[model samples]
Target: MAIRDQSYQRYDGPVRTGRSWPVIGWSEFRAYWRFWRTKLTIFAVWLLPLMYALLVLVEAALMEPGQLGADGPGHSHLNLFVSTQLFALALVYIARGCGIVSDDLRHGTLQLYFSKPIDRIDYMAGKFYTLVLLGVVSVFAPAVLLAGLRTAFFVQSDMLAEIVVLHLQTLVLLAIAIALLAAVVLGLSSLTRRTGWAVLGWIAILIVPLIVHAVGAVAADISPWDRLLSLHGLVGLAGDALMGGADAMPEWMPRIVPFAAIGALIGAGFAALNWRLSHLEKIT
Candidate 1:
């Protein structure tokens, strides 16, 4: 026979205090992985990077020193690598990251979140870091692979040091790109309650100059080939400047311009995110 023992017990648990945004960030990150769409998208994004790695392998195996356009730093493969970063990440952001803030607003969850042990900074940081992680997966991971492959393949030559320098240069470039893209999307996500609208807004901002060029709002001189004002072009320009390849950059688009423009865009992103969060705080 089982006897029921009834007694009053004091509740005891570790008090959750201090900055707790990581709690929010970590939970959100886990939830994102649970979605099948995220799994499929991640799988698809890796294919291009692996395919590009084939070129590196082929050059090392068969081609002459300069046969496969191997003149620039790391044979200009890193430059080509940068061009592949944006498109796949854009799909992931649209599928899920674009909803980072809008979903909370749509579901009326901010009040509930505020009821817990976190504030807006924590919320923003968590959300910001989530997108940055996605950027790492979509951009930096593949880059490191290529960097290592190049380093290993060219270990016997003077190009080893140059390869290391190029990798370091790209580290800076990738950081700027990952952070800027995350901020821009997160900031835009805060502006509306519909993820679809947020996605459209992000896409528009990223390619605004192209839309302008198409409608003649931009000068004819700023046609497709000469445009450097867009986000994608600015990133490429910054890479060129950092990697000592800015000689080909146009006179109008000075090297300093991309640095200044990237800074301004990053600032603008956080400002927009903060503004929306402040509005939510007032209401909550």
Candidate 2:
């Protein structure tokens, strides 16, 4: 029988400081972007904005000077663009986020992640940022760029102020939508070990409420506040409000309801994710 010394020896290698979440985020971002399918989806989403920009340019060249006012044609176009971007956000969230956490769990990598230098929050943040990056690229960035292009080339001088205000509103709305949706998807991802189940959960959470809301809207008289049960309806209402549309919501419905609903959703998502990870950590 032989026993060898197992004394600790500190290596002279350079130590990295600061939170590693950003590094984790960047690494995940690059890895996802490397996939051909992801790249194709992003390109396809961007093409929608590009096509709309071309239409705007053609309309600007052919139309009369006063045909498009600040809040008339321009506002309509902006709303359409925002709606398209939101749709793209949903697709990207489902495609890219479905596997983020579930893959780690299914592959038995959760223990490996927990053994690293980062905490659960950092791990979650890292995975969440990947979806955020996709949203910014596929939805937010294109919308802002198209709006700036339209403002610069087509919008009139007198209407620039109004257009700028609308643009700012669009920016804020898009940011809120992206953050809330990312939180919801990531939370769902953390709950399941199978990617397909996570994807199905996301679809159920997003779609089931819409069906209920629609049936309620049709079969029974429901208050505007009742629409908060539908996540899609709440976001649509918020978007309408941002665009100053008349159909935003009934005056009886408080303006804060949409914000509150989205906030609650995001809170529940993160709470579920944290609880799952904490229990997993204890068991591992």
Candidate 3:
């Protein structure tokens, strides 16, 4: 039985069989829901989104008469949409994502989780979905619901198709924004064990760049489109897509440039954050 004993000793640690896409996806969703249920109360989770939806409804109500449609040719749906998107979506992402990973580390949760058979990717997947869901509840769901309400209350044949198209466009735009926000927040949180620092660092990473960009804009005579590197500018561009306006950009640059650049920053930020966190060894 010496051979049998030797064989048993050969593999001492937990064995990992990496998961497939479908399994990973479902696991992510399920884990996210579980965390959501536990962390957020019924009222906070449901009420917050509903309240944001009402804000959009109020904005629709306040819009000038006959201004909902595209017939003006000087139409400005993009501005309103971008503003609402930023206001509605930013809080949820900032709160949950900024705290998630850092809290795990500070409270010794990650060690407990790692002690189980779970992988870093799985852990990150769960956190990512949680942030995505929060964004949907706040920004996406509210935007669509409010848009539908607007279309129902004030129907205009000329603008209805455009509004509908804009609504569809919002889904894609919000998805990118939410993904970027969630990924960067999660990655940053993972870098530090202090939740407060994680959040502040996130804000600094986001805001400081824009502050620098703003100074550069004036000193260098930079075009507004170039300022899209600023946090507010990128947020505004995302909003503009929904509102159908982007006057700040140079007329020569294609409309897609701002949106694309914002998306790239978010994507790159997420990758860098995740790479940093994933490589981190536990501090005893």
lDDT by residue (tens digit), candidate 3, 1-284: 66756644465788657743334445544554566543453225446446646766786678776665435323245445545565445555554556666766677765666676666667667677667766776567666676577556456547666656666665666677777677667667767778888878877866786678778867897666645765556755655644555564456767787778876776675675567566557442
Assess candidate 2 and give its TM-score to the true structure.
0.86
| Alpha-carbon RMSD of each model | 3.7, 4.4, 7.3
Better of 1 and 3 by lDDT: 1
Once fitted onto the true fold, the runs of candidate 1 whose alpha carbons sit more than 4 angstroms away are 1-11, 16-18, 64-76, 211-219, 223-228, 245-248, 252-254, 281-283
Clashing pairs for predicted structure model 1, backbone only? none
121-202 in candidate 2: lDDT tens per residue?
A: 7887887788788888888898888778877864455777777788888888888888888888888888888999999998
lDDT of 1 at 217: 47
Best by TM-score: 2
Clashes (backbone N, CA, C under 3 Å), per candidate, total 0, 0, 5
Which residue window of length 10 is worst by lDDT in model 2?
Answer: 70-79
Clashes of 3: 5
What does candidate 3 score on TM? Answer: 0.67
TM-score of each: 0.86, 0.86, 0.67
Residue pairs in clash, model 2: none
lDDT of 1 by residue, 155-206 (tens): 7665678878888788778888888788888888888889889999978876
